[model samples]
Target: MNRTSFRGKGKRVEFPFREAFWMSLEQIRKRLKRSIILVGSIALGISLLTHLEMTNVILATYMSSMGSTMEAYQFWLIIVSLFVCGIGLINANLIAIYERYREIGTMKCLGAMDQHVMKLFLIESLIFGAVGGVLGFSFGTITAIASSSVQLGINALSFTPLEAILRYLAISTGLSVLLSVISTMYPALRAARLNPVEALRHNI
Candidate 1:
């Protein structure tokens, strides 16, 4: 059995999976500060929004007798926080695109396909989203407890509905991840569609 024949016998080796994976990591490493900023922004947004929404649910569903008025703040916070977070996430991804023009061009010139570029950016964003989701939920829950404590004079967290708390954590994390990916989509596509020639010429 000639090893050479077997080695050269495969269909064209396309799927730049390994390259894209490593490059995705490299992209994050190189832009560590920006990545951190993006993740933090997302986490803050998700945490605050989740905390407020969950608070509203608990109050409305369980304690409607006493805190009906407070629920208004929770509702508005959810809407405003999410909108701001969405804007920040989109801008962060777009900034990454502008910053990485040269890298993208280099990869394309080195024979990477457009889809590979797209996949790399997507992988980066997904990783960011997952990390953000976890951290955001943790912080949000803690903040909620603290705020509740203040409102209820140190007995705030003691009265929380465990089921509602768990439910909100799961939902908020999922929402954070989903929103993160959605916001990154446009910029990722734009980066993938860049003409290698023009990309190389681009200086930013």
Candidate 2:
């Protein structure tokens, strides 16, 4: 009896981590597949901007090389990159809003607060962004290192290696979280407004 009571006392009431984790994973998996489709479309639009950026970069490089210009085209490329990123962010969030209604509704039904549900989704997005950002950064960095090694010795890369990696990771994660928050606002608002009876009546 003492053992049983001790065990019972040791189990504390907390957020349902296991169930929530699985549910969130499913939501993310679905979102990933959908986002990829939307992103693929957006990537095509981005490619045009990228080519324009390349042209601008080449022209700016020419100008710089000839001592005729002060700023590199790369500076302007950052602006266009942000614009493309914003569009991609909007697309990703819109898709999430459309796709995750059922999951959101289920969370609401389970006595989870609307804000908590929203946070859950937001956290999911953050995790996806972090994992993807880190992996992509690592892969790209390695590829760049390898390619440069063949052409101009590994040490020829001008960046302070650790500082560059940290800067890229920080920027990537921050931008990702910003985009995720913006993308989630609409859906989060909708989830917050759900009336329990109506939420249950409709299939998400």
User: Where does candidate 1 clash, by residue pair?
Assistant: none
Best by TM-score: 1
Clashes (backbone N, CA, C under 3 Å), per candidate, total 0, 0
Q: Give candidate 2's error at residue 189 in angstroms.
A: 2.6
Q: lDDT of each prediction vs. the true structure? A: 0.74, 0.52
The local distance difference test score of model 2 is 0.52
lDDT (Cα, tens digit) per residue for candidate 2, span 87-156: 6666666656655565555655655666566666666656555554454445545554555446445443
TM-score of each: 0.81, 0.58
Error of 1 at 43 (Å): 1.1
The best candidate in terms of lDDT: 1
lDDT of 1 by residue, 47-99 (tens): 88766755555445445665534456666877788888888889888988998
**For candidate 2, what is the total of clashing residue pairs?**
0
**Residue runs of model 1 more than 4 Å from their true location after superposition:** 1-13, 16-19, 57-73
